[model samples]
Target chain A: MKRNGITIGLIILLIGTAVTAAGIGAMHISPQQVIAILLKQINIHIPVTYDEGMANVLWQIRLPRVIAAILIGSGLAVAGAAMQGLFRNPMADPTLIGISFGASFFAVLTIVVLSSLPFMNGALIPKYYLLNVTTFAGACFTSFVVFRLSKTGGRSLITTLLLSGLAINALCRALTDLVTYVANDEQLRSATYWTMGSLGGVTWSSVWALLPFILVPIILLPRLAKSLNVFALGEQEAAYLGVKVKRLKAVIVVLTTLLVGASVAIAGVIGFVGLIVPHMLRSITGSDHRSLLPNCALLGATLLTMADVVSRTIIAPAELPIGIVTAVIGTPIFVVLLVKQKKQLRLMS
Target chain B: MIITAQNISYSVGQKPILHNLSFAMHPGEVTVVLGPNGAGKSTLLRILSGEQAPSSGTILLNDKSIQTFSLTQLARCRAVLSQQYMLNLPFCCEEIVMMGRYPHFNNHPAAIDRDIVQQCMQEMQVAQFTGRLYQTLSGGEQQRVQMARVLAQLREANAGDVTGKLLLLDEPTASLDCLHQQACLQKARDLAQHGYTVAVILHDLNLAAQFADKIILLKNGQLVKEGSMREVLQPDCIADAYEMEVEVWQHPDYNFPVLVPAEHKVRSILKTSNKNNIHEYNSRSFVKG
Candidate 1:
């Protein structure tokens, strides 16, 4: 009952933030006007004195960005939660596991290689969708390679997994840099903007694209909640308790890859949203993935919406990248938690 | 139902850990695997539970190859408790115990499932810690919780109907107190009496002598003795397996074997080697001494 209440509270909070975020951007529309305009879209026009330009900016510019933030935030957070549970480590995130870097490397490659290819000029395909597919494949391939590298005598060790992630992250970064040298001016700008991460330039089309990635995982991951809880007991024990260990690992690896890859393709490589949101919710939810996953989706949506509001308004006119704002906010929380953990260890010892 | 292993062996690189081990666990008996350190007791348990495959051999469950059984199918038939239990996440104690019901996740645990979790936690003396974080429990308390988890798994497997089932425990009583140790082994015996097959790896010969219907002695990855009480309780084979001289005698009150180290007993198994019956000589000499 208490768990349900907390989740409900998070959902309310996310909705409240969404409304406030949409209202506060370039044109300072009131919350009442925001709701009035939103209702007008569905043919329930409320009689209110609102400027046409205010309504247009609210609908076109801010609403898509708000929806994009919710999806990106929710996707990154749930992916982080699942990865941490699968790895049986509190600090594990998709970024730490090299999924994000692999996506970044592949995204950069698509941008550079497509620019030189003559077919890209002919517009045979929507180039953005092609980039998304390539990123997804690259992230999945990275996971496969890392899994193979860490297997010793047919058993995959989580101890070796961390070192493998570090090595792969470094290798992918170097390769991305080496390929960046071959790009022309226009392609270089696209690659640079993508690697830096943003939710700007969003449209209703991007929100449509983000839906399958976020909703599929949101629906699928919670079904594994019980299995993931069993996993907390240790892999061998989990298998003994009827969790098909191999299949569980594969599903988690692929799901997280899809989520991180899609988020990267849509909003570039946003850091710290995955790390910060899930860890904060884990303490409150007590690590049961049933409660943990849903709460992560709500709170991750709320947090990044609030962060987007801050990033766009802090310096006014010239907006900071959403990635920079998240790190600036997340680093202090991480440091404080670390110090508290150290103190607890000292007391325990 | 029967769990039968034939010519099972395991090796790490070139070093052999278990060799040509074969055994059939029977219903209505507690079969305790007794051995010293590095005797492949846990390895054998792992193989029997279908967690680890043997390097070269076959294990059959009810006349079917174990390799053919899916993990969920194998979980529906057997439950295991290993030595090490580690979880970095801070799950509550009840949640930890409830994890044993994973195989039934899709079916949605009913009231009976909730009742089993509570009952097992109470039996293991961990009911008060249900709200406490599992990581905060002491080692012994955590061991009891894990035992409850193992029991919950077995109870869930038998929820459909009680039949001959397999229970493999690796030192389940290692970190337990005297009260819990007796309680745990007694529970194993109670289940065994109800046609559940029980296998345990025990360090205490006295406990095995007290509860086990049959005992298997292992030494250096090889079976030294496998039989009923009288066949394997001989002090000679135990001394060879454990590499320490010991004396065994029937308890004066209960008539079951009572073990005392040679260094602790006077003229213990030393002057009585030539006796016609060691039990008879020991009873006379021990009582007289």
Candidate 2:
């Protein structure tokens, strides 16, 4: 009952933020006018006043960016929750484990190298699909490599998992830098913008492209909430309690890869949203994934949209990177949590 | 239900853990597997619980092959309490116990499931800690909560039909206090009295003597003896299995055998060190004077 109330409250918060954020940029439309414009699209006329310029900005630019923020935020967060549960470690996140770096490396390669190939211009597939597909492949590959590297005698040790994450993160970052060093002026600017993460480039096509990857995982992940709870006991114990541990691991790996890959391909590497959102929700919801997952979706969307609003307006005419804001906020909280986690682990042992 | 193992053998890569072990765990009895470290007792329990398949042989539960039962179906009838649990999340004690009923429900648990969870927590004396975080509890408290979890798993067979229910506990009392250790084994005895087949692995021979209706002694990945307590808890059988001398005595107030390590044969050896100082050490027979 308490979980339901929180869920409903988060939904209202998310809607409130999205509508208000839509009206904050350039033309400054009011919340009432935002709704009026939305209703007008559905063929319902309202008495409120809005010009063609404001409507175009609201419809084409602001709405897609806001929706993209929601999807990307929700995707990264749900994937983080699932990954942490699967690994049975609170510190596990898609970005922390180098999955985002892998996607970024592949996406950068497509932008700089693949698009420049003479045959690529005449290829049947667009660069957009090619980049997304390769990014997804890279994410899947890196996650599996990390998983395989950490597993010893059928069990994955937390120490080895984090160590491997560090190694892979460094390796992918080096490779992305190498690609960036060789890029032309135009490609370099795009790659630089991508690494910092922004929803400014998002359009209707990008939102549509991201929908299946984000929405499918959000809907399907909660279905495994019961099993994930059992998973908290330990992998072997979960199997003893009737969860097919192998199948569960495979499903989480694939689903989280899809989610993180899509988010990275669309908005570049947005770190810490995945890690922080779920960590905050776990304290309130008490780590029951049934509540934790859905709450993560709603709260993650609201928080990221709010962050986007702050990034857009904080510097005025010149926008700040959303990743910088999240990092500045997330780093202190993450360090404090890490210190607390170390104490908890010491107490447990 | 009677779980029968036929010539079960298990190996990991090139090293074998269990060799041609055959046994049947009958309902209404407490069967204890006793062995020293690395004696394959844990592997045997894993095989019987269907967590691992034997390298060669088969296990039958209720006259049907274990492989035929789906994971969910197996969970409804059989529950296992392993030696180590990796739960670091801040789940309430009731939530941890409620996980036992995951197989019995979908999405949300029913009222009966909640009732069983509460009843099991009460049985394990952890009802008062229902809202406390599991990670904040002591090791013994966590073990008791896990005990309640497994009890809730098999609570469906608690009332009328008790057949086909089996409980496997691997060192369930390892982290418990002395009083709780006895209480835990007593709870297993009570479950056996109510028609649940209980199989436990215990390192304490005296505790096994007091609670086990039947005992299986394993040595070097093979069964050394399988019979009643008196037949399997003999001094020679235990000494041979553990490579230590022991004596069995009758309990003063109970009808169970009491085990004491033989200490009378200890010999003190004195040796001159390089510095010309004398060093004295007792042999392995030195338990207590």
Candidate 3:
């Protein structure tokens, strides 16, 4: 009953935040105007007074960006939650473990290398698809390597895992920087803006294109919540309780790669939504993954939408990077979590 | 169910852990595996639980080769409680207990699953803290919760008969206190009486004497003896397995035998003892049991 209440509350909060965020931009649309515009588009005509261009701005600029934020935010959070459960470590996150960097690295590499190729002139293989495929590969590769390196004996040493993540993040960051060094002017501008991770680039077409990739994982990961809950019992213990451990791990890697990879491909590298959202919700929901996962999706979407709104309005004329806003808030929380659990971390070692 | 391990041998690379051991665990009997450290008791239990495959042998569960059974099939009948659990997530005890019911349900747990989890938690005496996070429990309390979880795993919805189920426990009493240790072994004994095939790996010789209907004594990864408690818990067999001298005495108020370390050697050594003689006594001076 409590889980249901939390779920319903988060859903309502998400809708409220999305509407409010949609109304927030340089050319402001009121909340009532935003609702009227949304309802009118859905064929529910309502009498309201609003500027003709205000409706255009809401539809063309703000709404897609908000929807994109919701999709990417939920995608990253669910992936992070599943990774934390899969690794049996609370500190696991896509950004922390270099998955986002890996995706960004391959994405930049594709733009720099394939953009000038001879066959790239025509749509032999769409550049968008080629970029996504390479980014997914990158995410999967880094995740597998980090996981394999961090496991000593049968247990995952938490210190080793997190340290290895740091190492991989450094390596991917260096490689991404190298790719950016050689890019053309327009490509460089896009890549640089993407690396900072803004929702500024999302269009109706791009949102539709990114939809299936992100939606597949966001929809499917929750179905594995029961198995992931069993996974918290350790790998061998989970197996003893009849979970197909190998298959579950494989599916998680693929789904999370698809999730983080697609989101990074779209939004560059948004950090900490994956980490802090799940971490906060776990305190409220107690890490059951059934309630934890759905609540993560709803709250993650709400928080990132609100963050985007703040990023837009805080500087007014020029906007801050969405990643910068998240990082500013997330860094202190991350440090606080680390400081509070210093003893627990030592005990784990 | 009768689980027969035929010519079981296990090795990690060139180092063998178990070698050419054959045994059968029967329903309605508490068979305890006893030996010193590194005797491969946990390894043997793991193999029998179908978590690990023997290097050169086959395990037959009721005349069917264990490899033929899927993981879900084996899990429905057999549950293992290993010595170390690597869980640190702050899931509540009820949620942790519900994990044992994973194999029996698809997505949502049914009423019968909840009932069984409740009953098992009550039986293991962990129901009082069902809402507490599992990570916050004491070591012994955690062990009891884990015990309840495995019990919930093998529990059938129909409640009474447990004929084909197998429960394997490795060093279950390591973190437990005196009363809980006895309570844990007593619960295994009770489950055995209810027709579950119960096998445990224990380091305590006296606890084995008190609860084990049958004993499998192992030494250097080889079985030294396998028989009833009276036949297998003798001083010589235990001393051969552990390489320590012991005196077997009949308990004054009980029918079971009690093993006491022979202090006569220590007394004599102390009587005339220099540091050199004390070292000699510990090294090789005592008579082999």
Candidate 4:
């Protein structure tokens, strides 16, 4: 109950950020109008009325993006926490080891590599949905392969995970380079856009499709907090403490892949939120997965939603890419965190 | 129910770690495993804890194969504390201790789990540091904290089932101060006296002499000696297994065999060899404590 206080605070902050984010973008709506439209769409009819145009902008345009932002932010953060826990390394993140880019690579492969081979066909996916499909495939496949390589002596070894992660990362980079070598300008442009990361192009379908990933992590990862806690004692220590470590490894691999894969797909490979949010929350919430996982998800949602709000509104009508906003905001904060966390890093490693 | 490890042979690639080692741990005694580094003390501990299976042997617990016991059942019967735990997260000391209660929590942490944790912390003398970050603690303090965690895990096992309860620790006192080291091993000794099967791997032959009821000496992954401490800690056996001459004597206070490393023999041998040319060897770091 005491630990839940931090989680509850983060939840409140996320809700406030989500609400405020909905009112941002080119077509400005009052916070009240945003809430009314959202409530009406969800069948909670509000007494307050608003224009249909505002409803279109709120329900159809801005709402999907906001939901996706929240989902992706939390998804990435939770995935990062799980990865860090799985490896027992604080420095572990989806982006650093290239799990985030794994998804981006798949998207590139689908768009650039797969489409180029003879008899491969003109398109792997429809032009509109190309980014989402490819990225998701990339994230899932790379993570699965990398984690499977983590097995040593019938147990998952952190060294194996790190080494395999490096191998997959290099393979993805090489393949992506090859893809770039043969791509036409339009294909390169799209590939480049996806790789640089963005929260743009989030349709209602994108929101709905990512719901399973977002929800699965939020629900499932917290349940694994205790197991992850034991795992922090090292894999053998976890087993000694009665943790089903081999099974826990599989669950961690699956959950992390689902969360990171879906988030990368929805948001085009945003970085740092996964790394920074969990590290920061661990400092506050104290690495108890029970508290840290949910709290990371909440803070992640709030931070990224706020970043999206800034990305759209900082330049007003002309928008900065959401990925750039997070990177800009995230990198400086990450440096500060790493500096503050230096002692812990040194001692543990 | 005792653990019977027979003809246990473990190897990695072409290098053998443990070779045809056979041992049976009886229920009411403390077994201390001692050897030089890389002599497979940790490998043997890992095998007994079921963290690893012997490459070419069988380990039976209570006459049943070790693998036959589910992790939950195995956890209830035994707990292990390894030499080092790499932790980067800034977990509070209490939370770190609470991780020991994980197996007992079942679906959720029951009310009594906190009491168990608190008792173990007090027993380990780490109750005062419960609020600090584990990373902020001194190495000795952290080791004690983890000892508390392992002790808490053992506390969860059924006390009435003495033979079924086992505690395995590997160099648990390696980072501890002398006082804490005695306290930690004394706790294990007390637990063993209460009929729990206890096994430990320790580098300090002196501590093993003081507290270990049964001493199993290993060298080159083979069992060189096994018996009561007095029987196994003979000067010749100690010299052979450890590659150091030790003068064994009964402790005046505790009446246990005390192994005094023959530091004089080494210096005397060096002096005889290089009486006039001892300048270079004497100035080197090896001869100092």
Which one wins on lDDT? 2
Error of 2 at B212 (Å): 0.3
Task: List residue ranges in candidate 4 displaced over 4 A.
Answer: A42-49, A112-134, A144-181, A184-186, A344-349, B157-163, B251-253, B263-289
Tens-digit lDDT track for model 3 on A176-280?
788888888877887876678888778886687678888888888889898899888878787787778899999999999998998887778889989888889
TM-score of 4: 0.89
In terms of lDDT, model 4 sits at 0.80
List model 2 lDDT by residue over A1-349, tens digit each. Answer: 8889999999999999999999998779999899999999899998999888888999998999999999998888899999999988888888888888888888888888875787777553366567678889989999998998889888788889888988999999899889999998888987877677777778888888888889999999999998898898988789878999999999999999999888888888888988899999988889999999999989889989998998899988888888888778888989988999999889878
True contacts kept of each: 0.81, 0.79, 0.67, 0.75
Per-residue CA lDDT of model 1 for A72-170, tens digit only, reads 899899998888888787666677667788898998998888888877875523675776788888888887887788678755566687788889899
DockQ leader: 1
Misplaced by over 4 Å in model 1 are A118-125, A148-160, A340-349, B12-15, B105-107, B156-161, B264-281, B285-289
For lDDT, candidate 1 versus 2, the one ahead is 2
**What overall lDDT goes with each candidate model?**
0.83, 0.87, 0.86, 0.80
Candidate 3 chain A lDDT trough over 10 residues, lowest sum: A121-130
By DockQ, rank the candidates, best first.
1, 2, 3, 4
lDDT, candidate 1, at A340: 69
Evaluate residue A19 in candidate 1 and report its C-alpha lDDT on the 0 to 100 scale: 92
lDDT of 1 by residue, B1-289 (tens): 6878899999988999998988887888899999999999999999989899999888888878889988888787789998978677779999888877666657467777788999999988889997898878877888899989888877844454658478999998898889889999999998888778899999999888888888889998999998996678777778879987666776466757777777666555565565356555556534534
TM-score of predicted chain B versus true chain B for each candidate: 0.92, 0.90, 0.90, 0.88
Q: Please give the range of 10 consecutive residues that has the lowest summed lDDT in model 4 chain A.
A: A122-131
Write down the TM-score of every candidate: 0.93, 0.94, 0.94, 0.89
Q: Please give the distance, in angstroms, between residue A296's alpha carbon in candidate 2 and its true position after superposition.
A: 0.5
Over 4 Å off in model 2, which ranges?
A118-125, B264-289
